[model samples]
Target: MSVVVKTSAIKTVRAVTFACLAFAVAFAAAPASAQDMELKIIAPAAPGGGWDQTARSIQQVLIAEKLARNAQVINIPGAGGTVGLAQFVTGAKGDGHQLMVNGFVMMGAILRNKSPVSLSQITPIARITEETQIMVVPANSPIKNAKDLAEAVKKDVAKVTFAGGSAGGVDHIMAALFVGAVGADASKVNYVAFSGGGESLAAILGGKVTAGISGVSEYEGQIKAGKLRAIGVTSPKRLPGVDVPTFKEQGIDLVLTNWRSVFAPPGLNDAQKKALGDVVAKMVKTNGWKEVLKAKGWDDAYLAGDDFAKFLTAEQARVTAVMKTVGLVK
Candidate 1:
């Protein structure tokens, strides 16, 4: 009877071991480790804006893929994302699980806002997506294409009041670049700044500005409704679904791809940066991430880890030069 009881106990232990092995195999094949805990993603802008969308996307994917048990987006919009940058630089030190969504706009924002804490203080995780900038005019206006706008801008740089967001944001930079490309003084190009896309849209629709510069995605609704006519897209080639020609195709030697990126707080060691970057790189390769990019009309421009850090340094210098030349930064 003792031998039989011992044999029964061994059989039960073997059975439990087999079950545990099977579960481990299944979990490994799953999206991500189901053991990860909560994560925090900060969107340094108002809700429903581009930064908000990116943070929320990170939140959604992390939770849905079981990469994290929970994730949240904290909005702190002001001063064109510099307000949040300042706080993050001082507060998020040594935080391994925190991230902030920032990009080309922030490059300009930092210079314009004159933030005490610059982007150089943070750690770059990855560059996720990029979009072509587009120039548009009110539907009722006479400017039809890139050539027309170029001629007008060349004739009187200050006469064509280009409207965009923030004094040094991508919109402002693109307008200045366009004017410079057309043989005009970029410093003399008149650019009026709005606090948000909604305000810029209102001004454009109300004919309060001569032309508008922004991402193609932001103006899709108005462009579809026949309220704004796209003059040119600042891409080497025309983007899919956008009927406008590229600035290059219009005989304008200009191309600019505004990219968005993810950055972590300072004080992370090399290992921590690699771990954080690896997760985001893996996330971008997922099907759910591809679907998110498709829905947002953003092109995948993924560059992770060291490569992204190098890119950030180069971009900072390039934009600084351009901004100085355009007189947006002294």
Candidate 2:
């Protein structure tokens, strides 16, 4: 009877061990289910801006494709995204479900504001879209074209007030570059920064500012409505379906495009980073994401993995050099 009891105990132990190993193997083999993914995308700017628009587009596509169980966007607007960056770094550390929308604007903002939190703290996922910047004035303004605007800036750089999003953003950078390209003093550019696109649009429409610069899509509706007159677009050549002449065509040697990208929070391990990146990579390839790009007039600038990382590094160096040359930084 004692021997029988001992044999039964050994059989039970072996069976339990084998069952546990099988469960482990199955769990390891299965992919993460959609129900397990809850995404929170940070816009890092108020609504109606490029960052907000990008974040929402991502959210919409992710949900429509069932890539995520749920997704939401949180706006924290200030200091050209530094305010939001600080919050993201602290609040979302080690979280793979959290992503922040950022790009050239934040790059310049970090340098200009000397923000405590920088992009280095985040894991880059991908660069999604690129859009041209449109220079516009109120329809009733005297500046009829890019040339007229150039003359105005040359006449008085300090008096030609330009309204755009954030102090060190792409809009501000374009304004300064435009001034310099037109043989005016870039440092004296009267750039008035606004926290949101709506505020700057109001300022432009009310004629409070001399002109405005923003992404083409942001001002496209107003331009088409005859509320605003597009003077020049920062593209090497005229964009398809966009009637505005290129800055180069207007005899201004300037070309720039604002790119938007997504980043994961810090502290993600290799597997975590790869998992998040795979989701984004999948999203970008979907028809839903492509439709969003087409509707928004955004170019398919999708880049990912080590390629995107290398591009980001190069962009930082390029932006820093340009900012220094324009006197935006010493």
Candidate 3:
């Protein structure tokens, strides 16, 4: 009787173990669970801009991952993203449903343009990705590489104009920094501001500007089509599959990288912040999201919660110092 009982006990244990394995297998194969909550992602620029693209990507991933039922993107364009920033700080207090897409460009615009609603007034949710700005010239241009561009800029900074996004934006800042790094006066850089890359592309193609500065992705299509020549990228290393070398590699010591990220409105409790951060954190880990990053030509620079807030502080100081050096701020 004792032998029979011991054998029965072993059999029972094996049965339970098998059941657990089956359950695990079923869970792994199940579809992503649907979330009931919907959220609003604000793109504080016109449609077809960087912020709008980021916001739309977030919406796509959030819904496809079933992290949110829907993520609606709203565009509020003006004042280099400050116009919408003011509304977020004042109206979205304690509302975790609202998120804004901004980047390194905002820091310059806020300082140089003297925006009333600074990033400090909002909640820093996450740093999503970083992109390298590119120095591009039209296919017909004489400037062939970063060295050639440097010579042109140093010859007469004002005569060698850079066409890019709005004033005080990352494109503008990159052009200024490149000029300053090459012994040219940063403040003297002839930066022609436009609302979007479309406008800048047209100007560059039409020979209205000496060169163009924008995200490498912004010029990828034209570069591939032989419409534009990418001289150098602001990245520290050459990007894979892209022929352009780094600004450092081209004998220019300047390295300029712009970040794209999300922020929430102030007045949220810790739980609310956690919820938003968790959603983004999960979104980043998904295979779909990883593919999105690859397709969009953005590098993974994900940081969230307390660490992100600290990053905001450091970035504010760093950008402020650069602004002073470039004479964008007094």
Candidate 4:
């Protein structure tokens, strides 16, 4: 009787094992299961900055369009965006639910911070928009136009110091390119880097710095308040209603615009990648999103995921070449 009982028990165990294996196979072959996904819009800077504003705008548009149940905008600030980037790479890697709203600043951070993961490591979802850079000075600075500033800098490269939001950031790069065009040794020019646009603007307004190289949107309010004077914009054509001249018009050619884009972690499945790209393409079409673009003075530049990826690669190559000329890269 004991021998019979032992045989029965072994048979039951074998049957249970077979059932578990069958379930595993079924689950493996099932469709991608994202019954509900939490979309995290990571703003690489602190609150109220351009990246933060972008993430919030995306969150609002995504929810308003009913594209997702909920989207959260979280601010992860540090290391010129490396802190947030590292957090994203370490935590939500390949979890299709997470998205990062990054700008070209990430490239500068990668070059400077020596981050383990660069922008190329992530999947470029899409580029939302682009904004032209503007040259600004204190409200009452004697330097009036782009030529005036250039003459002063040419007289003595260190006579006027330039301030920017980040070292080797978009503004810094623009400044370097600007000085380089005017037969000036850009390396000899005094360039100061503050934490963000706010601090840089403050330094300029306090007369601590002679001029500032920053995004037009950063000092848009001060421009309105008559506290900041925009002498020149680094665009081929002048901006609408801004009364600012282009650097080209002054015979100092320099055009550098920054773009905002979304990226996901590496190793996403085809379906997961397509789903996120679809949401971005759809979100850009909404009236609400368009209004945000207009309000922020961003150009209506939209590119699909794959196309945007190509653009990033090309832009990366162009920037890499430029940086090499300036000794910023190998």
Candidate 5:
């Protein structure tokens, strides 16, 4: 009886040890999920721009939702996002934890500046938000409407300076288009390129430039406060709740919307890509992200995976064509 009892006790001890060993092996073999990894998002524009806003919003949602162990934003502003794009492509290859925010501005900057690193070098993650553009002058300025500004440009393209985001960006492109629409020289637009919305806003408010152009949300506050006067908005019709008049209604024949998106670094394998995409997909569906959209007045333009890739390709072509038409590029 004593020998049988001892043999059973030994078998029980062996079973416990095997279970613990199996648990350790399984835990060690499992890959770290996105929620367990720290994330770094690069805003390729200066602080107070649309890209910066988008990055911060994403960082907030990621941390709030516990979608990441931690998240942070790094700003690398210059050359219309080319400086940041170059660094991201070279430094963060194969890193699923790293991402960069960019959009239509970068497309024009790439062609105009002849950037060595292109968007094709990065992994397309998703297109997130879009917003219309606004053209404004200081509240005290004599330019009362789109027609007045068009007349000024027609009178002297060199004398009328327009301040906006980086050269060849959507702001610059819109200025050129507006000039062209008014029978002025598109190539001769006296545009002053700023690296950020803050700088451009200051120029407009200080009356340092004749006018300014930027995303509508960037200028909404001042427009409402009577600091800046919005002459026209590049929308087909007036925005639902906003009273800003459309360029079409004013007879200038212009409509353009700026889109913001996130891209991962190059060299990600299928698994890494899928994991990052999953994180972004989850973030977009959250109530926090929806609130961000509501506050910023950004449209929920979420398109993920291969669909985003295809959309990006088509966008490049469309932007290039528009740039050429406006004489921004050859």
Candidate 6:
């Protein structure tokens, strides 16, 4: 009986050893881990908006500088940015390999949609660039400067209808700020929302709307062509090669610069985060990035890691307050 038991135990041990070997072989035979990873640049708006432009700019620079051998810019636009953000939180969470390019609209969309995702859900990788808001009117319109536009609105609120890309988008918020500066009843002021900046530009130039608010970068070409008149820019300082004046200089006491930056999904390991941040820092140092910013009329304001995290928190609060004051939120 003892001999029989020993033989049975030996047979059991051999079976377990063979199973382990087979499992190891199968795992080893599996496809090699992907060396080229997908980094997603989620633009929260349709193509041609500032967010989309920023994504494309980053992609071009990253590839040109070899900061990323394999990368892609995906347009996940909707719900004034909430739809794309939902994907960012639920689908891209903890995906250190993916990156999203966003700006102040991220906050606007969250507040407007009451989204579950916030800045805290992602890793604030680095601030890429900042652009000023430019107030524009149709080329054929008589409105020419900030003072003329403000006086026209104050004289008759309905005389100038402001158009924006979305109800709570950066452009809309800038229009609100202008209304407040001019002491107009924001609710009473005529404001229209389009699907995107390109649409809003068309409405203004086609004479469907009296005025439009969008990033200076988006309307740079039209402004240069003399097809659109820039009444005021939201930057604190005048931009280079652009004759447009700042709202502050016009005594409007308003400055609302929009920024674009990169964010990775949350919970990256230290080594992985460092590697990603290093790549971003190298990209920022490149002349390619500088030239792109110059072309887009973006001012340099690069912040990474903890600094960016802090900035996001403050901006979140600031936007919430603005929205509340505008009666868009409680």
User: Number of the top candidate by TM-score?
Assistant: 1
Residue pairs with colliding backbones in model 1 are: none
Candidate 4: regions farther than 4 A off: 1-37, 196-198, 318-330
**lDDT against true structure, model 6:** 0.79
For each candidate in the order shown, give its overall lDDT on alpha carbons.
Answer: 0.85, 0.88, 0.85, 0.81, 0.88, 0.79
**Model 6 per-residue lDDT tens digits across residues 251-299:** 8978887888887777666655776677778878899999987776788
Candidate 5 per-residue lDDT over residues 1-330, each given as its tens digit: 353458889899999999999999665433358679688999998888778989999999998998998989999998889999999999998777888999988999899888999999999989998899899999999999999998899999889999997677888888888888888888788889886577888888888999999888888889889899989999888998878789999888898889899999999877777878889999999999999999989988899877888988888997887678667788
lDDT of 4 by residue, 6-40 (tens): 88899999999999999996554332333244588
Which portions of model 3 miss their true places by more than 4 Å? 1-34, 325-327
- For model 1, what is the C-alpha lDDT against the true structure? 0.85
Question: Tens digits of per-residue lDDT for model 1 on 161-244?
Answer: 998877887887888788888899988879998877889899999999999888889999999999999989988887877789
> TM-score for every candidate vs. truth?
0.86, 0.82, 0.84, 0.84, 0.80, 0.81
lDDT of 6 at 163: 91
Model 2 has an lDDT value of 0.88
Residue-level lDDT for 318 in candidate 6 = 75
Better structure of 5 and 6 per TM-score:
6
The alpha-carbon RMSD values of the candidates against the true structure, listed in the order shown, are 8.2, 4.0, 11.2, 4.1, 6.4, 5.1
Q: 1-330 in candidate 3: lDDT tens per residue?
A: 353458889999999999999999665433233396578899998898778989999999999988999789999988778889999899889887779999898888888878888998998888999988898999999999989989988887778988998777778778878998888887777889897678889999999998999888888899999999999999888888888989898788877778989998898877677778778889889888889889989989998867888888887887787677666799
Better of 4 and 6 by lDDT: 4
Clashes of each: 0, 0, 0, 0, 0, 0
Candidate 1: list runs displaced more than 4 Å.
1-34
Error of 3 at 288 (Å): 1.9
